[model samples]
Target: MTDRTLYIVVCGAPLASRVGDGVRQARDRGWSPYVIPTDAALPWLEDQDLGGAPVITGNRKLGESRRTPKADAVVVAPLTFNSLNAWANGNATTYPLTTLCAALGSRTPTVAVPFAKHDLAAHPAWLASLAVLRYAGVAVVDPHDGSAVSLEPITSGTGDAVTQAFEWDWALDRL
Candidate 1:
């Protein structure tokens, strides 16, 4: 594999169930991929096979050394409404959030694919948070098609279909 390290920050969403696809895709591209899932995402990953990519959860103890290597790039796929808002506001209340904040602060190349229901996306806070992330130079992509130029909300009942069609190349290609 190449010397590049790709950190895939997964959130709680239907799309998260397909994280194994991303891990395999990253490895095939010659990059070492790591999964950093939000606590809520744990259940989704239970049935996934992430190849050999390590899943990093919880924060390290004060004296503990870092577990994963420094990231060459980061992909936050299926970024939920809650996590997206928290990350945009710089709230590192959780391990996944902390990782996202650090990646943004360090200027690490990052691509985020937001997966929110249409109703949630209609909230004023949704667009505001997205704007905040865009201002921070994070590439915001549409999980439906990996379009960086626009982000559309997922229809309430279409999550499963959308997730099935999602490809890791969407986020990876952006990086």
Candidate 2:
């Protein structure tokens, strides 16, 4: 069996440079890092030099992929607000969501870093969805403190505050 312990899934049009950095960070830490980009994210991945890491398209059977063998944990970085709502409601409309559902179903531990603006992020529905996800055993990292403006260190960067939810060691410990 392979020695991969972490699966990093990316969705949306995130910066290639930032993604490359995150992937490098995961590898430097000794975790076999595999980057899976949803269909929407494929074009972006194709444009970047991923340093030979496999980029699995979301349309395929993700659960059966070689990357899923013994994933100690799954992290969804820069999770879209829509994706967060879908996952919270058990809606697997996309490959990433489906894979997330499968991982959670198999009790493989999952974490999400939702990216959205302050107003959208604070919506009651969003909060409710987060509650449901947390209740159902999915760790939803809150990137904002009470102020709701500044982001926690882990979540701070380009794109959105949601990236904070996928901080490597922080999410790993939860798993």
Candidate 3:
């Protein structure tokens, strides 16, 4: 197995399941998974073992965490629209956003799975932010597509959507 560690960052409750799935996928493929969550996700993170991976909180430590030597890639699952906007605008106001910014700045391969309502998804600001992220070399996985399966409703966490986020192998291909 390679020494590379994949960092999984969850920004909210719903994303914890996605991160868990990602970790399982990574482990099944013989890769190491490191879990991290923002303050907003603390409640959920606390409930999970995350396969014994270290979980860091707060923005002050995020930059340092991103620079961890074994890191190979970073996955921001269930990335909220607010966090996405913050990251796109280079406004690292929170830990997850700060870690993402640090990862990008350090040339770490990062992928974001954005889960939002159709209206918010279609907003011009969101589109602009996505464009900025793409131009900056950050891959934004639009969970709206049928490719990534969703564990909850796409509209309000009550309706189901296809879960088709890129698998670990596909993600590695982008790197």
How does each model score on TM-score?
A: 0.97, 0.72, 0.77
**Candidate 2 per-residue C-alpha lDDT over 123-149 given as tens digits, one digit per residue, 9 for 90 to 100:** 677778777866777775533331222
Off by over 4 Å in 2: 13-17, 61-68, 142-175
Q: How much lDDT does each candidate structure score?
A: 0.93, 0.62, 0.66
In model 2, residue pairs whose N, Cα or C atoms come closer than 3 Å (at least 3 residues apart or on different chains), thus clashing, are 114-162, 155-164
Candidate with best lDDT:
1
Clashing residue pairs in candidate 3 are: 147-164, 148-162, 148-163, 148-164, 148-165, 149-162, 149-163, 149-164, 150-163, 153-159
Which is the better candidate, 1 or 2, if ranked by lDDT? 1
Give the TM-score (vs. native) of candidate 1: 0.97
User: Residue 29 CA error for candidate 3 (Å)?
Assistant: 2.6
Q: Write the per-residue lDDT of candidate 1 for residues 1-175, one digit (tens) a residue.
A: 4799999999999999999999998988988999999988999999889997899999999999999999999999889999999999999999899999999999999999999998999999999999999999999989888888989999989999999999889888989
Stretches of candidate 1 exceeding 4 Å from the true structure: none
Residues 25-95, candidate 3: write the lDDT tens digits. Answer: 77776667777677777776665546666676654443454444546788887677788888888887776
Q: How far is 16's C-alpha from truth in model 3 (Å)?
A: 2.4
Q: TM-score winner among the candidates?
A: 1
* Every candidate's CA RMSD: 0.8, 5.0, 4.3
